[model samples]
Target chain A: MSMNDLIATIKKVLEEVDVVLGWTRSPAAGVAVPARFHTPDEADGAIFDSTCTHNLAVHLPRLKNSKVGIVAKGCDARSIVQLIVEGEVSRDRIRVIGVPCPGVIDVKRAWRCFGFGKKIEDAGGRVHMEGRSMPREEILLHKCHQCQDQEPVIMDLAAGDVKSVTPPPPPDKTGIRERFAAMSIAERREFWREQFSRCIRCYACREACPLCFCRDACSMQTREPHWTGGQVNAIESEMAQQVRTSHLAGRCTGCEECERACPVGIPLMLLLEEQNRIVEELFAYRAGMSLEDKTPLLTYDVNRDGGWR
Target chain B: MPKTEVKIIGFLCNWCSYAGADMAGTARMKQPASLRVVRLPCTGRVNPLLVLKAFREGADGVLVSGCHPGDCHYNEGNYYARRRMEVLERMLPALGIDPARFHYTWVSASEGAKWADVVNEFTRRVKQVI
Candidate 1:
């Protein structure tokens, strides 16, 4: 369906629900931002563009007690299923209006698309994608190409007509593991040191993550005596990286929001992807794959056979 | 090879592995003194992060020992520990740590000799690398 038809459906649904959560072009930027529509009239600004990279599922748990209507893409729907499985949100409290996304564009790719000399400006809720005739494929988000599922896993009301699309192939984690293995110890240390040095201790990544639900009591915020000093030095950087990565070990849904939110352009998703790969290899488990599957870490079995001990 | 002093942290399940270590001491079984044992309620309580944290805190090696798989005092504690450790073992090498540095073994309360042997072998291997 056209973007107009999708917005019209969302308008109707927004009038019936307490709130309709969707993406609106950020007022000050070329990026998409999450917005809540309580009235049908406000739906005109909602756009389902290639820049709509924000996963709407992050808002569901916060509005769990209230009836909410969400505009979700495939990855967003997967996150919803995961939240339901974890008992973080009730399925009955939310209505998912699914959309099939081809792929969203990364900001760096957008910059490159616009060319080194040219600058693209955001004006009146529209992005002018201009430069030296760059192909659209060049600007697409890396995760979208690797996305295995295009159809929403769970949806109460799908907006566009359902289209049968082949899921992307399973990620080649062995290749990725080999790349890391090939790096020398000094090279690995230097790489991480440079990446972590750029981190300004901005918790935007944590705040943007849908699964990182811990609020004020965040590990990074403990300061009575200060577990690790608040400085963005190497020791503190390493601690922060370890703490953040470990927290998302089994829980990360591979949303990539944390990486996107990082102003420093840290490849945070690589760490998460590695963790996801490990989880898959060991237990044959995938996070956000199904609402019915419980986390392997939280569940125990006496008769289970294939483990180390 | 130059001999490097390797620090090893051993997490022993209180019900079995810790008792097994005590039994080994009572039996005067010779074991490597490089290990620092932390008594946990059960091996299942050992989060993979703790193992990583051991390495982060300069432990050259980590050992998690529990009751024989089915003999968990909590019935399924060791089984859960086994699953977590197995996953950690597979992932550690990718994170730039030697996979052999993290070891998981089952030591029953009566297996004093076995516990000593496991520690000696693990310490020796860690020494070779560190």
Candidate 2:
């Protein structure tokens, strides 16, 4: 479907729900941001394309309304399923507008191609840099390089021909974990020590996470028992890192928003991708894969094989 | 490596494993001096974080001993703990920590000789690693 068709649908959806959510162009070039549509005029700005990268499902509950219409990608649709399964969001209240994904422009990777500070728009497979152009294939975000869902798993209304599209093969995580595993214990400790040391203790990774709906009620903000204070000491730094990532043991969706939001550009997703792999191997659980599949930590069996050796 | 004894931290569940350690002492069984025991009400109370905390506090290794699968005093506490530790051990290597540095087992309060054997065997292995 074209942008006009999407706008018409949004206008129709707005009549049913409290609000309609979709991607609209931000003031910055090459950036499509989450936009809430309360009226037809507002919905006119909504567009669907490669630039529509933000997973809009996260903003649904944050809109603070009982019922809302939101757009979802294959991955975003899975996030909605996991959220509903966990009872984090009400399924009956949200209307989904599933859109086909052709790999969103990862701004950071584009920076390496377009020379750091230039603003540009993406047209299909071409990166339009002012008057110059190149294939958009060269600069996908690290996670988008390996997107497996070209179509939404669940949707109230789907835009474009999802059935005709075939998803590219999922990226194999070969050598990713082994790269860190190959390091000596002391080398690994020093590696993490330096990484955590750069941490200014900003929990942007935590805040940007969709599954981390706990918000301010997070124990990271606590002081009485002091799980790990906001102070940036080496011990506290590692403590904070340990608590935050470990809490995502079974629930992470590999959205990589944490890596995206990090001001210092840490490879947080690579680390979490490894954790998700381990959770899958040990318990045969992959988060957000299906609503019918329970999270590994949330459910267990007496016959499950124990990995302690 | 130094000839000193390894600093092993044991999280023994109060209902079975803790009483098992006491039974080892009462029987005058020859147990290794390497282990420093911390007893909690049940293995369920031991969060995976505590094991990480023990390593951060400079422990050479961690041993989580609870009641046998069907024998937990709280009915199913050890069963849950078994699941948590299994996943935690699988994750340790990805974090660059040697998976060998962590282990868990089932031991009842009456198995004093078995407790001595488990402690001696684990202490020897951890000492070799560190």
Candidate 3:
């Protein structure tokens, strides 16, 4: 669906809710920002395009009590389903306007295609910056390349028909899981140690995550019986990562925003991918699979689940 | 390698497994000295972080023992522990930590011989892993 059509749908959705959450054209060239529209006039300003990288449902929790409408991509809509399953929000309070996502633009790769600079127009598509056109191959995020859901599983209205495009052949399966499996145990440990050592204890990863609603009381910042010390080193960083990833065991939707937000480019998604696999293997559970499916980590079955052995 | 000593952290529930270990001592049952037991009120209290800390502190193995299914003194702590440890153990290998280094079992207060056997066997596995 084009940006104009998306705004038209959102404008209709705005009549039923106080505000809607969706991507708006950013001041930054070749980017989209999460925008909140309280009125239909403001709704017209929202844009849907390749650069709408954010999972806008991340804003829903803050506006949970309000009747908030959201322009959810496949992933964003799934996140909302997971949130409802976890009892974070009720379905009645929030409205969903599912939009067809052709795949969002990866900002880092887009910069490379734009030769580190670009210009912006609120209208979607074709990063119009100084006669520089970002090749389609370079702009789509890796998640988009492997995107399983082009159309949202759940939605109240669609702006227009979802684009029917064959997802490119699955990329060479050089994902971290296969790579880590090939490495020796000691080598794997050394690899993660080096990657985590580069973390400056920045909380960007935590901030970008849509599911982590811990807010000011997050364990990372606790003092009494602190979860992790303020020390800026590998062990502490590793500990923080472990606690977070484990907490998200069956809840992470594999959004990859944590890795995207990490300033140091730590391979955080690799850890989460491995974790999601374990959840699937052990509990036959996948995050955002269904609204009726309870999170496995929070509940256990006696007959189906026993000891790890 | 001159028989590098294997260190194992044993987290025992106060009601059943800890008493089971004590009975092993009173019965003069010999067990490996490799175990460093930390008694908690219930297996449910055994935080995954504690096991991670044990590994970080150079424990070659970690063992958690509690009441049998349907026999937890706190009614369902061991049941909860079973699931938690299962998830944690499955995830350990992803961090390059050998899943063999962690073990969980049910031990009743009357099972003194079983307590000795669990320790000896776990010590052997840790020795092999380290």
Candidate 4:
């Protein structure tokens, strides 16, 4: 319900887990940055505000050997659920402190508008910064504009008022969505080619993905199979992204971390969102929704899969 | 612009489609020369990326052929391959490849005639698109 409730919950959870992954306000950045708390005393620094946009579950897979306590927003919890279903993290070894999200703001967007490192706050469905206020809907992350889970999907401990948040409104069928729908297959090919031409191949998109936990074994950079070339040109970059999008066909949770992390600002979500939509339409399945779900691509229903043909 | 010869990459499962193609060849069945065959153990080994790679390498079309759904040599390989191919087929359009450029179908070892007909139709279809 409040900052105290979030801190108190994390403190309680810290007793049972080795580390609690949450957000702490940064003095220099003037926004919430992800931090790990090891003790009840460190939990005092934990805060859950609109600026706490980082998904803490990205840290869970790397810490497979230790018990972890994660402060999960509704979207972050989906990533955690997916990790559990994939056997990357055991559910029992981790504690989930669910924070009923009120849709986090895209702090970079805010900074771009209000000037960087300004005191930004969210209150009464609006974002406030440096004596200027704007409607919260105008500054929220694109993922938040279409958020389906205001309440965490799975939680061992509830930290905030789960009932207080309302579902996100339907997204406007304009901008990228409308333009994407209007483009033909040939046109889309050109669009993506032009877009990927600017890619520097930094691999920030891969690194920020919570589900892309392949680390050193990632095929994106593997030289043996030589999936993509070492060059940073349009063809190689586009193929690298194709590898990512195809591999994430049924597993991506639409967290948009990959797009957000991309330094060159490639709209990676366009490919991912399209694949997610196709997966849902064909199989009637949404990734990371349940622990029992086998990835649709990994399994088959011989008698029932006729419509796709 | 001058018309280019359509180059199709055919990934055939060894037990059925590959043998079926061999039979067609030995029978001297008249078919287009567009398709080049790569034989794999089963359709299950036909990863979707292989299809994409074929396209990237300038294959005008890709055809994956295996045993009929209930008749895989491995009993279940084609069943799994069926789902993957279906998914990959749906994704082609999104990647800007004409959906008509890729196809997957079943061809039993004895169906030499059927294999010839499939190759004729698919190559004709690919020629139309390119």
DockQ comparison, 2 vs 4, better candidate = 4
Task: Score every model by TM-score.
Answer: 0.89, 0.92, 0.92, 0.97
Q: Which pairs of residues have clashing backbones in candidate 2?
A: A125-A136
Question: Model 4: what TM-score for its first chain?
Answer: 0.97
Estimate, for each residue in B1-130, the C-alpha lDDT of model 2 and write its tens digit: 7346789999999988889899999899998798999998888877888888788888999999999988888888877787778878776765657777888889998898899999988888887777
lDDT of 4 by residue, A1-309 (tens): 789999999989888899999999998888899999999988899888899888878899999999999999889999999999999999999999898788888787788899999988888888899799998877777888888877888899998777578779556432886787789988988988998999999999988999999999888999978899969898899899999998998999999889878877788998888889888998899999999999998888876885564
Each candidate: RMSD: 3.7, 2.5, 2.7, 1.5
Ranking by DockQ: 4, 3, 2, 1
- List the global CA lDDT of all models: 0.76, 0.77, 0.79, 0.89
Per-residue C-alpha lDDT of model 1 across residues A269-295, encoded as one tens digit per residue: 767888888877666777787877888
Per-residue C-alpha lDDT of model 4 across residues B6-100, encoded as one tens digit per residue:
89999999999999999999999999899999999999999889999999999999999999988999998988888888878888877878999
Give stretches of model 3 more than 4 Å off.
Answer: A119-139, A162-165, A172-177
Candidate with the greatest DockQ versus the true structure? 4
Model 4, stretches more than 4 Å misplaced? A172-174, B1-4
Where does the lowest 10-residue lDDT sum fall in candidate 4 chain A? A169-178
lDDT of 3 by residue, B59-86 (tens): 8899999998789898878777887788
Model 4, residue pairs in steric clash: A1-A160
Error of 1 at B44 (Å): 2.0
Q: In angstroms, give how far residue A170 of model 2 lies from its true place.
A: 8.2
Give candidate 1's whole-model lDDT: 0.76
User: Could you give candidate 2's per-residue lDDT for residues A1-309 as a string of tens digits?
Assistant: 588878887888888898887889776655677888888889989988766777776775576556889888777887788787787778788888877777666676666666755556767568776677767666555566677766777788876666655355344343444566678766877777777778777888777788878786776667754667788876777777677777888888787788777877666775688788778777777688776778777555776555334
Best by lDDT: 4
